[model samples]
Structure formats: structure tokens, C-alpha cells
Target: MQIATMYFKDRAQLKLQDELLQYNLNKSKGKFVGKRAEAIRELDDFEATRDAAKSIRQRVLDNLDTWLEIFEENARARGTTVLWAETPDEVNRHVLDIAARHGLKKAIKSKSMVSEESALDHAIEAAGMKVVETDLGEYILQINDYEPPSHIIAPALHKSKEEVSALFAKVHGTAPKTGIQELCAEARAVLREHYLTGDLGITGANFLIAETGSVFLVTNEGNATLCTTLPKVHVAITGIEKVVPTLEEASTLLRLLTRSATGQSITNYVDILTGIKGAGEFHGAEHMYVILVDSGRSKVLASEVKEALRCIRCGACMNHCPVYQNIGGHSYGWVYPGPIGSVITPMFIGQEVAADLPNASTLCGSCASVCPVRIPLPELLRKHRETQVRLDLRPVGERLGLRLWTWLASRPALYAWATRLGVRVMKWLGGYEGRIHSLPLASGWTNGRDLPAPAGKTFRELYAARRRAGRQT
Candidate 1:
């Protein structure tokens, strides 16, 4: 399938008119915001947690190679095989090779954004193995036949309860008009069988502990535990940056992450699995495997947008962002979406592929305010704009306008005269309404909302007038 990240403008335009999308977007974010607000009020040390997470991430990045090496050695010692994947294709090849070697006919998976980024599900299906998504939202998307995830956390937030009921009946052979719990039960009944019988299981790590070679998995539905335990061959695909120094650091991050992402003080199911199940253990995969995927993350680590790596994939920024609240995640056109995606997508996917992303923001700073790790998202977005200008990727009209503005601003006399003349022209154009319904060469801004005409005088002129009046008094 063609990735949509390159066509953000087109996707956003279509998304704006989608009544279903708007309803879900508003409902989903509103619910999360309420929960998060309450959670934040209860946590007195939330700021400290953010600081700790930020510091921990900074340390990890500074010694990233050391930490990854340590993690590899410890994991190997625990009887777990670690695969290093430098790119998406390499990740697919490694996963396919594993499946081929095992002769796995079917696989079940939990929600894993890294896997999405690698498109591993499609690759495995192309290799002739069925992969079932165990998470409720993901299961909905999967059974719907190849629909992409629209959000970082909630895959099917775009779906309504009624729509889900209809889909469940159509796909799962369930009774019609199922309630939410009934639908969940139906999915669980089917997924339980997949868990018991699947040849392989794949999952993503919330945090990879370098100390004991543990993969931390968090989920609300408790399916990740099944994904890890029920299948005899378990595979974890995660970015190299997921590695943390210790379980303690992981815990601190988890506290902030859950609260910020879903407004929960703690997620219901937080599992920390290390190594294969020992001889005395009742269950767990005999052969444990983890694929540490670089997948252009190394380039991000090497770039000015390295602060984006501090993200724990909490999804808070997306939930709080006004742009995302209206247009929804699919409009961002990538695996990751919203503020975080806008900052790093260009760097990961390239400036050319996601050129419209930086311009998609209002620079409101809401995302940064809600982010648990405190990545300066607006500043990073500004950097992306600078990158676009440096690369000369902007349209000729926008470039020329910016150049003209710069020229006028550099000349104080010209700027003052021009502002006065422009104000008069706008007032005349607005007539009695004092609002601009249309403007030459700037219809995009004026098309929807009325643009108030400029005040009679500039700020500089007003300030100067106040100064003269005060001196005379």
C-alpha cells in the first residue's frame, strides 16, 4: 500500500469533511484529557517524574551504544537471541527467516508500533502466514481487512460503537447488535484460541531493560501477556532507543507514560518479562527473541531533532494537539502522528516526504505542555521549518513573500510606512464590516474565517503616542 505521509495536505482536506472521523476524534481526545487532568491533579510529583524521565533518556542517548551492547550480552546470557536490524527490510527479512525456520503457519500479535513501522504483518502475510492482531482496536482494523491504524494508542478510535457492532457481526460470526462488553467477549473468545494455538507471537516493548534483558509490555486488555506467554516462539520488535538502564528508570517512565497517554495512574497490565521461561516456570516461550530495530532511528539520534527520541510513545501530544483533535491521526499520513510525528517524520522519512508537516501546526505549545518527557515540540517544529527553508523546498510564492517581509522589516522607515498604508487599505477594503472576507493572494486564510482588519495604528505608533502623552502630562 502506498504510505500517506507524503500527501498530508490532500489527506487533511478529505479528513476535515469526515463526520465519523470528527466525532471519534473529539470523543477520544476529550475522554483522555479528562482522565489525564484528574491523574495529574492527583500526582504531586508529576513534574519530578518528567524531569527524571528526561534525564534518563538523555543519559541513554549519550551512551546508547554502550547500553545496547550491554543489553545484547545480558539477553544472550539469559538464553534470548537478539537480532540487530538496521532497516525495515532487514527487520522483515529477520522475522521472515525466523518464521520460515520454525515453519510457523499462523501468528498472533499485540499492538506494536515498531512492527507497524516495519510493515511486518504484511510481510509475514506475503510469506503465507496469518497474523492476528490481539488488541481490540487493532483486531477491529485487522478483521476489517488491511485498514491502517489511525492513532498511536487507539487504532480504531475512528470507529463508533454502532459501527463496531456491525463490523463484529460481519467478520467474527457473532450475534447482531452486540454491546461493547459482548463484542469484547467475542473477540476474546476468538483470540483465546489464537493464543493457545498460534505458532508464533510478536509484540513491541514499552521499555527494554538493559540490566536484566527484560521487555516491558503495557496494555489495558491484558493481551500482551498472552502474546508473550501462550505462543512457544515469542518475538519482540522495538527501536534501539527503548533500552533503559534499569527497572527503576523504566518504572519512573512508566508512571509518567501511562498518566500522560491514557490518563491512568497506572495501566492495568504491566508485564516485565526477562529471558525465556526457566525449567520450573509453568509457561513462556522456550526460545525468546528480540529484534532491536534501527529503522532510521540512528539518523534521528544523529540529527538536531534528537530530543524526539525522549518520547516514550505515550500518545499524549496527539491527544492534546488541536490540529490532531480536528483532522485526526490518519491525516498525518504516517505510523506516528500528531506533534511528535510532525517534528521527527521529516527527519526520519526525509524533509521532502513530509514537507507539509511542519506547517500543519498552530505553534500553540499544548503538546509540549502535556508531554511527559518534556520534549520541546514547538521548537523542534521550528527547526523543521528552518530545515525546509535551508533546503529551499517551500513553494516560490511563500519564499518570495517571506523574503519581501524580511526586506521590509530590515528597513524601519519602510516597515512603518508600509504598515500604515496596509492598515488603511485593509480598512477601506473591509468597509463597514471591518472584516476581510477575501484578500488577494491569501484566500486560504480568509476563505473560512473572517480576518479582522488591522487596527488604525501599529503597536510602535501607539507606544510612541503613549510616551509623548505621558511626558506632556
Candidate 2:
């Protein structure tokens, strides 16, 4: 897929509107509302579980270096080869090297966000290899010429069923008038063939257990299992932050992840261990490689923003965020979206490229409330904005105007003069109706509305008159 970076604040509101409408439509069609409500209500201590998950993740972040070393030891013991890449180019090169060594031509992949971050689809395609996405959401994105995924779980969430039908017809050599069910059936048949014939598979791990070198994959459609097991060579790409200290810790986070994401007590399938198959093995990859990509995660961890590392990608924040619900994920114009994206995108991509994302929020705290790991999402976004302003990445007009306002605010006489001048100008703009349908300085505030004119009397004048009236009394 062609991945594009965007300044979130610049495009946030419009994106949010799209996401909100999309979520509402999805809810109407998918029973998401009732399902989530029932699942939330059924848990005796959902809040407690959320807290437990947060605490465990906090400890992991605090001891990340120690846990990573331990995880490496354990994974190697299980006969899995672990490779670390410090950059996207390095990760891509490493994966390509593996495929080249195996002489792989066809590969299957499960849903992995880290792969999305690395632009793996385009990378592999550029290498003259055919890679197929096995997860339904990912498959939709893959067939659509690798448009960036709109939602973490449901990549085609922004697309209506009609649109999907059209895409399927165009891609699968089906008739344009094909029915939705028929299109879906055709896709399933086609993907099953890839599963059988693919020479390599790639997947993303939900959790990496340091004690056993085991990566846990959670999925509903069992596509991950096929992507990992059916191919002769399997390659898994994941962010470094995915590691936990032990299998027990991984299980705890996994428990919270499923319920928080889709309201499932457990995903339909969770693959707990991975490595090369041995002699007489009925299923599993013959060659397994786990690529740990740092990207910008290490830099983020080194900073005070390490709390963001606690994220398990449950996507609860995006699901509940008002802005994300409205705009959907495309507006963020990055791999991760919603509140989490707002904080992490700037860190990874650079503040200048992502200044708009931080300002996109109303700081309503909805994301923080629903975050499975208790990440202070809103506060962190605000912090990003403050940093952006200090870095002079904020709009030039706003910055200059604020500097002038600060000067006026410090001098009462100048402030009073400016206030009177402002009233005179506003009175002129008010015209006969005592309102400005539109104003130059505040056009964005009144694009589809009107700005009320200031009252005739100034507060200073009114205060003096009131004092005189009291004396007379």
C-alpha cells in the first residue's frame, strides 16, 4: 500500500467527520453497539482487569531492557531465530534477504500493523515477490492496490459494502453485478488457494513472551494460523515493544486485548507458540524468522513518553474516541490512528510532519477513559502540542499574533486601546444587523455560521457608570 504522512491537525476535523459517520454505519449494520454493551456489562470486574493490564505493562516498560534480553534467550532456546532491525530499510532488507535465501516467490501474510508501518507490502512487491494478505481486512487492502488501512482491525471500515463488492469484482475477475455473498465466497476460494500454494508466510505477534521465545497471535478468522503454518518459510515482523517478561504476563495482556478490542472473551483462535516444523510434522513452517523492528520505538522509550509503549494495540481508544469515530483512520494519514496515533506519529515521523494531529483533539479525555492500559492519551497529545509550539511548528500567523497579544496583555493602557479599536472595527463589520456573517480574522470560526457583535458599552464604561449611580443613591 502507498503510505502517506499527513500533518494531523491540518486534516483532523474532516478526517474525524468521516470516521464518526463510518463508525455509526458500521454499528448500525454489525450489532457492535449491543455486543459491546453486553460484553462490558457481563464482566464482573472489567475495570479491575483493565487496571491489572495497565500495571503489568507499566512494569514491563520500566524493565524493558531486562525483559528483552530474557525474551531473546528464551526464544532462541525454542529454536527460533530473532533478528533486530534499527530502521525500516534494515527491516525490509532483512526480510528480503530471508526470502532471497529461500528462493521464495509467493508468500502469505496475516494482519500485522508493524508491517504496515514498515511499508512491507510495497517493499516485497518491489522485490519481485507476490505477497498475499490472508486476514480479511488486510486482504481487502491488498486487493485495493494497497491503500493504507482505514481501521486497525477492519481495514476497509471506511468502505461501504457496495464499494467492497465493486473492488472484489474488479480484482477477482468477477462480473460487475456479483452479489456480496458471491464476492465473499470467491475471495475465500482464492485466498485458500494461496494458503495451499504459498512458499512463505509472514505474521505479526500480539505478544512476545521472553521466557519461551514464543509469539502469541490473536485472530477471529484463523487466517493467522494459515499464514504461519501453511507456508514452507514463515517470517514474523513485530515492534520491539511487543515483548513481555513471561508467558504469564503475555496471557494477562492477551486476555485484556480480546475483550477490549472486539468484546470477545477470547479470540476464536490464538496461536501460542511458533518455530520451524520438525521431521514428520503435519503442519507448521519449515523455516521461521522473527524480525524485531525498533523503528522509532527505542527513541520513544528513551524519552519520558515511554508510557505510550504500554499500548497493546487493543484499539479501544480509537473505537471510542469522538474524533476518530467521525473522521475514521484515513485522515490521520499514518499507520496508527486516533489518540494513540496522535502521540506516537509525531515521535516517529517528526513533529513538523504531524503537527496537525496533536491539535486535532478537543482534549476531551474520552481516549484516556477507555484506554486499556491507562495511557494518559489526552495529556500526552497536549504535551506534543506544547512541544510543537516551542519548536515553532505551529502556524506562523497564530504564533505572531500570540506574541503581539502577550505584549498588549502586559500593558493595561495598550490593552484598553486595542479593546476599543477592536470594538470599533467589529461595530463597523456588524453593520445594520449588529452581526458579522463572516469576518476575515475569524473566518474559520464562522465559515458556516455568524459571529455575534460585541455589546455597545465597554465593561470599563459600564463599571464607572454603575459606581456613579451608587454614589447618587
Candidate 3:
């Protein structure tokens, strides 16, 4: 789904009015945040492990091209077809070409944000094949006519249980079950046939191991395992940053992924695939293809914010962000959202297209605190702002005002006098209530809350007054 045409300010204001959406966002993030904290507290060495994960990811990025070639060669040795795509158009074309050559009609898919970024499902459907999301959360979003995934790990975290029930009933022509188990069963029954008979199965890789030529898939649901084995041909899609030098390093990152994502020490399933079925394999796909999509990732790795690549898709940062908690994910208007999305959207896409995204934070550092990779998200966002200023992308009035403030801040005596004078002006505008209900250039900030009036005196004035009192005493 496309982002709303309204600017970020208007979009966020409108989203805050949606009581249902707010309820879902709060409830979902609260659960994730609480669980993540507990899981981390239980593990004494999570921070040390995070350091190891960071070091491993850094090493991979240091020689990304070398490791990628190593992975491709090893994967080829095991009879896997590896395709390197430099752009979204190239990636989609490659997948469609494979589908058309094989004459595949239907496919079962697990959740893949990389696929979402490439708009792969839309491309496949445009090519005239039925594609179904087997993961229950993704299944909900797909059937809802591509309602954007609101959360990274929990796509349907923005929808209430009742909402899911109603949506399923409407789409599947069956009564919605009240219980979670029954609900899953209902979805399972509906998707089982498609999983068994689809011409191809598509999934995403969590980590590509170069040493073993294996792609790892981690999920709570068993659907990924099915997608890896059920169909005659299986396709695994992931970003170029997913490759690591060895399996042991991949394992270390896996420990952090689940704990930071869902609060569990480990997820329900972890599947490692070396290649297609061999001569005597009883259960496996006959052919396997792994697509490494560079769609803006190569550029990201080369930029100042290369550390963003250390992200394991854990979703911890999003879960703790106050801004994301209030406005939800769709407001970001892209495949990724929250803190990481804010950083990457401008870099991957144009800074002008998602210009306001970097400004959508409180700079509270909640995201950084929760991040397992030690990325300085607030600093990266500040850099984006600096780039915007350098490009003169901000409004002319905003630029002039900032310049004036900078000039005033440089002179100490003038600054003290100006702040005191500003306090008087503010007190006049704010009235005896001591709160500003409205203000120039910031109506949005005070729309639902009040800004406190400035103190009557600046710190320098207060200190001077105290000094005079002490001398008289």
C-alpha cells in the first residue's frame, strides 16, 4: 500500500485520532517490550553476546564482496542456483522469469520483508499466478488487499483479535473462531492444500552461511519448513547483507534475533537448507534458488550509516520507540518503519521522498537502548537532518529562523538578554495559565497538548541574583 498523500505531520495527527489503531499499537508494543526486557534480564550475557554479534556483522561488512562470492560458489557446488539482483526491477524480473519458465500456477509464501521491499508478490500476481501468504499474520495482510505490515516481526500487530476474526470470516466464508488455537486451525485448514500442491514455494533467509553454503530460516510457525520442502521448486530471497562468514557466527546472531524479537530464548523452529534434494533424499524440493537482492543495500553499506546493516531484523528498536508507539508503522509509508526504517528510508530511497521520516522521533534513545547491535540511531537521524539542511530542503522560513537563533546564541550577553526578553514575550502570549495553547510555527506541537511557558529569568540572571544576595548577607 502506498503512503498517505498528506505530509507526515498531517498523517500522524490523523492516525492518533483512530482509537482502535492506537489500542492495537499500544497493546502489541507493550507485550513485545515487556517480553524483550524479561528475556534480556534472564540472560546474563546478552550484552556480551550483542557485542559478539556486532563484531561478526562488522567483519562481514568489511569484506562483503569476498564473502558473497564465497557463498555463491559454495551454493553452486551444492546444486543451488544463485542469482544476484542489483535493483528491484531486476529482482522481480528474475523471479517472474523463473515462474514463467517453470509454468508455475500457485505458490505458498512465508513472511519476507525483502519480498515486500521488492514488491515481489505484486509482480508475481501481475504475472498471473496465485500467491498466498502461509504465515497467519501475513495471510491477514495479504487478504486485506495489501494492508502494509505495521510491525516488522508481527505484521498484524495493529489489528485486534476481533478485527482478524471479522476479516477472516468475510474472506473465507467461515465463522471466526474466538480462541487463538481454533483461529490458527481455521487458517491452517484453508492454506494446507495450497501448501501441498503449489508449483513453487517462496521464503526469506535470515542468514546465509558461506562456510556451509546454507541459508537459515527462523520462524515461530512451521510454515517456513513447509515452504522449504513441500513444493518441487523453492525460492529463497534475502538482502545481500544477510551473508555471514561462518555458521557459528550465524548461530550467535540467531540467539539475539529471537530474544530481541519475541522474548523467547529461541523461536519454535530453525531450518537450515544446504541445497535441493539429492539422489536419495526422501523429503525435499527438487530444485532450489537463492536470490540476493541489493535493492539499495549496497549503497547503504557504502554510506556513513553502514552499521545499520548489522540489524538482524529483531524489531527491538521499533518495539521501544515512543513515536512508533503513537503513530503506528503505516505512517512511515514504506516496507520498513520505526527507527531502522527512519534511517534506511532516506538512504535507500531519496531523502526528499521520505524527508520527514527522520524527524518523526523524540530523540529519546529508547530505540538505541533496545538495539542489540549498538547502532547509534539518534546520531544517524541527526545526520539525515544535517544532509537535509545542506541540500536546502527545509522551508525557507525555517532556515532563516535557525540562522537567526544561531547568531543570537553566539553572543553570551546578547543571548542572556534575548532569552529574558523571550521569556517575557512568551509569558505574554501564554497568559496567566502558564501554558501555551497555541504558538506560531508549531500549532501541531500544541494541537493535543500544551507547551509550558518559559521561566521568567534565564539561568545567568538567577545565578547573578543569588550572588548579590550572598554578598549582602
Error of 1 at 331 (Å): 0.3
Worst 10 residues of 3 by lDDT: 1-10
| Candidate 1 ranges with C-alpha deviation above 4 Å | 455-473
Per-residue error for 401 in candidate 1, Å, reads 0.9
Error of 3 at 443 (Å): 2.0
Provide TM-scores for the models. 0.96, 0.90, 0.96
> Which runs of model 2 end up more than 4 angstroms from their true locations?
1-3, 7-34, 176-181, 278-281, 410-428, 431-434, 457-472
Higher-lDDT candidate of 1 and 2? 1
lDDT order of candidates, top first = 1, 3, 2
Write the residue-wise lDDT of candidate 2 on 37-67 in tens digits.
Answer: 5666666887887888898888887888888
Residue range 1-473, candidate 1, lDDT tens digits? 24678789889999999998788788887898989998887777878878888999889998899999999998988989999999888888998898888888888999998888878899999998989999999999998886888888898988898898998899877677657888788888888888888889899999999999998999999999998998888999999999999999998898888888888889999988899989899978888899999988888899888989988998999999999999988898888889998987787677898999988999999999989888999999998899899999999999999999999999999999999888888888877988889986888888888889876678888999999999999
Evaluated against the true structure, the overall lDDT of model 1 is 0.89
Q: What is the clash count of model 2?
A: 18
**What is candidate 3's local distance difference test score?**
0.88
